[model samples]
Target: MKIGVVSDTHLSDRREIRLPQELLGGLSGVELILHAGDWISPRVAEELEKLAPVEGIAGNNDGMDIVSRFGYKKIVEAAGVRIGLIHGDGYGKTTERRAFDAFEGQDVQAIVFGHSHIPYLERKAGILLFNPGSPTDKRRQLLYSYGIMEIREGEITAVHHYYASWD
Candidate 1:
């Protein structure tokens, strides 16, 4: 299965709103989409669902409506892989450790998280820690980015799709 991973969209309620075309293009043809949160608006998921089925959690910036609807953590099974999803909050410089703790004692093969808007991919202690970054808001980063993961035959490969800028 091919899965598109994105986070920290930070979209607003403007009716004229639209997602970055580059981000949308990169996500094309994926079997599923995983959002790590900070969507800010439900419309983000609604729009993403047009491309593929979406599973997501709420981030720190999310409003009560969103938080109540999506919560802060999720575990999903896809393509014979167990995936943990969360929007890493607090811990300042130690966000990664907090993310790991969120799924501690679980049998997850991968953990997808977001908050710092910096793309990250690492394998630690036999678990894949993936942060797709912010396709719409790169924050201090030099480029906007997202992630893609392919799972087959009990193996998983992840790659980041980076763009110099978003128009």
Candidate 2:
């Protein structure tokens, strides 16, 4: 299964960041989409939903409706693999660790998260953790990016993607 993963689209009504039509258009063949949140408006969610089925959680920038219901750790199954998703924005100092730690005991094969707006993909303690970064606003750099994951036969085949604009 192919999955398009994105996060930290800090879009405001007046100033919004948009996914290139090519990007969404390219994802037409993907089986699912995962959003790590910071979607400022329901319109953003609605827009993404048009592309594919989305599994999303609220970020620090989202409202109560998202915050109250969205779980810090979400378990999903893709291509027979147990997957984990988290929006890694929290109150404590070790926010990322704190957020990820929420799924310590669960049976997850791959974990995806975002919040620092930086891309990361690595294996730690027998678990694969991935961060797609922010597709709109970027910190410590002047570019935007997101990610992709491909699963085959309950094993992650390849799970990383990034995109940015020069203009």
Candidate 3:
């Protein structure tokens, strides 16, 4: 299964970029899409759904309605692998580790989150934690980025795709 992962698209009318070509183009052949949050607008969600089936959670900037409708987190079993998704508030407190703790008693192979708008892929305490970064909103001179996860036979491998300046 191919999973398209994205986060922190802080889109608004004032924001110059909405979604980039890298992300829209990369959606090809994806079985499902995961948006870790900070979508900032409902239109973004609507557009994303057109690419593939989407599972999303609301970020801190998301209004109450979005949060109430979307929930703070999501967990699903796909391709025989259990995956956890969250928008990851509590930024400076090691949100990744805290997410693991939140699901401490649950069964999950990996947890995905986004809040700092920085892409990260690493294993902590034998559990995989990832952040796809902000596809539209780059922070601290970071490049725009997204991620893809290939799952087969219940195992998952992920790759981060960042937008080049030329693009």
- Tens digits of per-residue lDDT, candidate 1, 22-126, equal 989999999999999999999898999999999999999999888887889999888999999999998655667788889999999999999989898999899
- Model 2 misplacement above 4 A: 15-17, 91-96
- Candidate 3: the clashing residue pairs are none
lDDT of 2 by residue, 65-159 (tens): 66665655588888788878888776765545754586898888877878888877777677778887776677875566777788876778445
lDDT of 3 by residue, 81-167 (tens): 888888878744676666667677778898889888878899866667889887787878458889999898878888999886534
Q: What overall lDDT, based on C-alpha atoms, would model 2 receive against the true structure?
A: 0.74
Q: Quote the positional error of residue 47 for candidate 2 in Å.
A: 1.2
Q: Which numbered prediction scores highest in TM-score against the true structure? A: 1
Which pairs of residues collide in model 2? none
* Per-model TM against the reference: 0.96, 0.85, 0.90
TM-score of 3: 0.90
Better of 1 and 2 by TM-score: 1
Pitting candidate 1 against candidate 3, the one with the higher lDDT is 1
Please, what is the whole-model Cα lDDT of each candidate in the order they appear? 0.91, 0.74, 0.82
Per-structure clash totals for the candidates: 0, 0, 0
